[model samples]
Target: MDEEYDVIVLGTGLKECILSGLLSVDGLKVLHMDRNDYYGGESTSLSLVQLWKRFRSNDKPPELLGSSREYNVDMIPKFMMANGTLVRVLIRTGVTKYLNFKAVDGSFVYNNGKIYKVPATDVEALKSTLMGLFEKRRARKFFIYVQDYEDDDPKSHEGLDLNKVTTRDVISKYGLEDNTVDFIGHALALHRDDSYLDEPAIYTVKRMKLYAESLARFQGGSPYIYPLYGLGELPQGFARLSAVYGGTYMLNKPECKVEFDTDGKAYGVTSEGETAKCKKVVCDPSYLPDKVKKVGRVARAICIMSHPIPNTNDSHSVQIILPQKQLGRRSDMYVFCCSYAHNVAPKGKYIAFVSTEAETDHPETELKPGIDLLGPVDETFFDIYDRYEPANHDEHDNCFISTSYDPTTHFESTVQDVISMYKKITGKELDLSVDLSAASAAGEDA
Candidate 1:
């Protein structure tokens, strides 16, 4: 227990495991510990029996739903953007070698009591049914302008500086309808709310470009991808990467407590009356509650069904974003669905999730707009969890705490936390210069 290391990671969640892997690869002696016996701490994929045990207590799942072992339900369901930072991290760390990824099937947005495929590209905008003939031409021109705009090319700026203008200004210049702007901002740009309209247009423009490039990468139905088994495979893969780089791991270690020195800086971790010395500590919010502040609550409904979500072009896996304007809410609601084609369920079963930032006390009522879209759910579970962010700086306390997962069904914000923590710890930004096309090919082959 007296063995000293460079960093002591106190949880095996996706964020912690990723840091463990990256730090170990940098030749830092790392010690990873978890109280649970499993690899993923909070973001684990569970079997049908485990899911029932967590939610239903002694109630057993219906046998007609299929064998318990055939299901892998994710606790926090999210998909990875094909060209997002998370995928770049995987490629840079070579974790892609440990997992296989399949493109998601569809991406849709809800507007005016109906769902429509988001017009992400110029062609899609021209053919979109969400707008009128004249509106479609306007949207197509807007899409072309965005597609051709380049940060370094002055001629492509279209006489407006995105950095100086707000997203609202750009949309207004094109005279796009309110509904067209809704899907482009909320669905394509992946904004959780309409707040981005008041912010700099450059941020939204870059995000939209990322979505288009990601969609073009696979030339598939959507811009996102999911692992073969589930997201639970992610932490395990990074754990293995850490192990290969000489990092030590301990699971089922009870009472794992962070030890602070007299100066209030994290020094080590103690478990079972034995302390492992370290210079710094990295952990999830649960390990050091006092260091984090509750920012919001996320309400989620997990559903089991016999078919794919209706009106999604029969997509076996899909992501649907319900803009707040359409639902008369302050934030967007997300619907994610996956079926046997993704290997997360049995031959004829599907798993779907509806989630959003909880704005009211009644989660069921808040999520009804998305729930109503699902035709028939065989079984469902609803929950609300508090979201937290670090109130203390890691540089001052040497305790790097990861934020709680948000309601969005994507890894963009999650990876931003990780990248931010990495910079704080190492005093440098992570360099991710890997070839994404090659990495995607390798992951597909795996």
Candidate 2:
């Protein structure tokens, strides 16, 4: 462990592994270490036995759920937009070779106390049951405007500047109903809360365009995809990439603490009796807890079920969003479901998750609206984790700490955090111009 490098990365989570890999590819000597004897850290997939051990203190899983090893339930379950930034990162780093995925079967949104499939195109939007006959035409126009929008092409802007316009203002121009705006914002834009409405409209337009383009990629049932086993493959894939690029990795390294100099800048990390020197240190919040602060709490319910979520057209894998307005909550609630079809569960079993930015202390009660849609759960586990962001000055300490994962069931925000941290540490924007078509994820229709 006694060595010098350009960067010493702590935590094997996806964010840390990705930074290590990208930096190594950029010709930086990097050393990555983790305290846990695992690859995925907090984002790792857990087998039924492992899940039982963590949540139930060694209680054995029920025999009715099938072989315990058949399950690979993700601790932080989320999906990848087929054309989103995460997939771009995977392809750019050539990490797609180590993973396979399946297209999610459907994308649905909760509207007026019921679930409806999210229209992925203008044509579908016209036939949606959630909109009125007149409202459909208005929405169609809005979708078409988004589809035709080009930041450089003023002709496509319809004389409206989204950069200066608020999302609420942009939607109000079409006279959309409150329910229509809820789904469009929370489901299509994929915002965690209503806060985006007050921000610039350009961001919302781009998100909707990403959804449309991703859905068009395979013309599949939905725009999202999931790994064959679970998200555990993601961190492991990046780890392999880093190693191939000459990055070193150490696992089961106890007390992997960041060591800073008297000038308040990090210089190395200490573990066991050995220390590896570095000019910069990157780690998750857990590695440098004192440098991060809690911003919010995420409440999630992991469920084992015999069937799919109701009203999803019996999708084997699906992502459903319960927008904030629909439930009179301050934040949206997300439901993610996967089955043996994705190889994450037994042949007759399914794995589902209901998560939200927790607004209250009671997780079980806070997630009931989503859980009620899951039909029946053979087994369920409720968890709450605090979300955090860097509190210390990165420039002062040369220590880059990743923000805790948000409650969204997508990788867009997570990738954004990694890219932002990479820019701050390297003083260069991540280059993602690699051709996506050259990289393929072996997949089937979910």
Candidate 3:
């Protein structure tokens, strides 16, 4: 390595990317790298920044821009797709838009397994998607104080309720069908990565309400914003910004070891056989010790891609599915069904995110640990279809499954943990032992 940086960011998570860019934008010589080939640690996308810029530049007059008058409705609409009963309600409430708020027609199959459309712009859909803590108590005082945000008004003091509500309480009080509860609970699990019963519903609601209020304020009407390309856009865009500030963005450069000079500071970062030198290091891939200790487990998701796209249209919709009969205190399974970010599949194909508990307790030394894959917390994945029907496609063959495990939860066993999740979800046999440990060994080569 020829250069020395004033600052070096340990992880390339979007947050770190933002910090790197901000520092670089402030005229600091920064070096940002990930321990993986991928740049975005948790947030990954192929073409996020470009798409976001285009979405932002769009000048089409928004039909409805929430309650705010000065915000741009164009980007907000893209968050919603165009389908679903819940989605329709959101549009009526001025919470959803067409472009920004797309819908995935098949979410929950209830009543007659009928197809249902989820509106992309629907505030309710996003609300249900995010605040799984609302225990059927509509119009609760759920507002948060964001230092002076308008929605922080005491009159809209709904967010304060999160301090008291548990996710379990919200699921029961809302009177949602078991399947719906499971689906929403599954989302909460994915976001928080633990038992829904463990998370405080009020806290979830408060966080959501805070974002929603921010959205309403920024976009004028709806408070939903998706990456122009996909969730991947945020990190990619920040990478671009990092480049402008003299930061180096290296894809596939997995960090093998941190060689500290005689001084305790990290003087060199080894990737494969190469190394880079820097002074200050900001470790941000996984949360630092202080952050992860509070949240003990990791969350894992299996992204399923099937050939022959389904009828759903919305981009930012989520379906929660739980078992009809309670499995212990929670449902049997929790599935978040949605179309992959626009254009993710080759067309005629669809993607859904299946959430389940990670092998958080498993030891890394075990070659292959077994995991019990639970179905959509409800009856079947297609169960939600009874309520809302979706577009048709070919058979359920030609599916690709991808899984992600939070490293903080399964620090030493991150890769193995992900592999175990995949096997449980897809029922396919895998030998990730080579891939897992080899990755660590290969990091030395990086």
Candidate 4:
């Protein structure tokens, strides 16, 4: 284990795995290690029995939930936007060949005590019940403006400059009401809060375009996609990519301590009394606790249900966003659901999660608004975990620690962090446009 490498990644989380694979593909020698035997550190998917063990004290799961092996419950639940950054990375690295994907069934937004489908196209905008007749016309025009606005085409600009204008200014031009603005900003744009309304309109506009484009990917009602089994397959897919590039992996390594040089820069990792040296180290927040600080907390409710969410058209999988304005909160709340159709649960059963930034001490109460939308949950588990970010990044210390996962049920931030960290570590931008066929050499799925 004394061998030296260019980079030694210390976690099997999706971000670390993607980086290791990208670096390996770039012809850098890499070594990946995880304290746990399985992939996905904080973002793992567990079986029904494992879920019982973690939250229910391992008192054998109820038989009514079906066999434990039939379930693949995600610890940190999120969906991949069909045309989003993660999908681009997956395709670029040829990780798609190792996995199959299914389009999500629906995407809804919580309004004034009701739920409404997010308008994806100009036609849907005009037909939406989310706005009044006059407001619908206004929204339809805005949708058209967004759909037609191209980055390189000046004619599409229509006398407006997204780079210099504010999103709030653009919405006001259309005479859009507060409710229309709510779904547009929080739902379609997928903003974490209303703060984006004050930022440059370009960011929000691009997000809206991405959402619309993703919705058009499968035309299956929503803009998101999930793997056939669950997100657990994602890390493994990237791990395979790394392996094909001659990267080595070690799992179930205990008390893997980062060894630093006399000058404070990380030099290697010591595990089981054997030290493997490396020029740089990348890891999740859990490894270097002192370098990260708690920023906030996430409260979530994991539920098992026999039926789809009440008002979602009986969709097998869906994402329902609760805007901060409608919910009177500082941040938008998210409700993510998937069923056996996605191979995440037993037949006829669904896994639904209601998650948001922790505003109160009680998770059961904090997530009540989103939980109420679920008709009757066969089983429910409430949990709250701290969110952290790097507090001390020693440029001299070659440790590139990742921030804790946020409460968002999307991969936008996750993929962005991976890309940014890749640049900082390798001093080169990760070219998502670069196609790598080397990773597709093994796809003999049974």
What is the per-residue lDDT of model 1 for residues 205-278, given as tens digits with 9 covering 90 to 100?
99999999988888888999899889999999999999999999999999899998888998889999999999
Give the Cα lDDT of each candidate: 0.92, 0.91, 0.37, 0.89
Clashes of each: 0, 0, 87, 0
* Model 2, global lDDT: 0.91
Q: Which stretches of candidate 4 lie over 4 Å from their true place?
A: 434-446
lDDT top scorer = 1
Query: What shift in Å separates residue 113 of candidate 4 from its native position after superposition?
Result: 0.6
Q: Which stretches of candidate 3 lie over 4 Å from their true place?
A: 10-16, 34-38, 41-205, 211-225, 251-256, 270-275, 283-317, 321-334, 338-341, 359-446
> What TM-score against the true fold does each predicted structure earn?
0.98, 0.98, 0.46, 0.97
Whole-model alpha-carbon lDDT for candidate 1: 0.92
Q: Which TM-score value belongs to model 4?
A: 0.97
Q: Which ten residues in a row have the lowest lDDT in candidate 4?
A: 437-446
lDDT of 2 by residue, 1-446 (tens): 77799999999998998898899899999999999999988999999999999999968988989998889999989999988899899888888888888788899999877899998578998999988899899899999999999999999988888999999999999888888888899899899888999999999999999999889876778899898999999999999999999999899999997888889899999999888999999999998889999999999999999998889999999999999888889888999999999999999799999999998899999999999999989999999999999999999999999999988999999999999999998999999987766434344332
How far residue 200's Cα lies from its native spot in candidate 4, in Å, is 0.7
RMSD of 1: 1.1
So what's the TM-score on candidate 1? 0.98
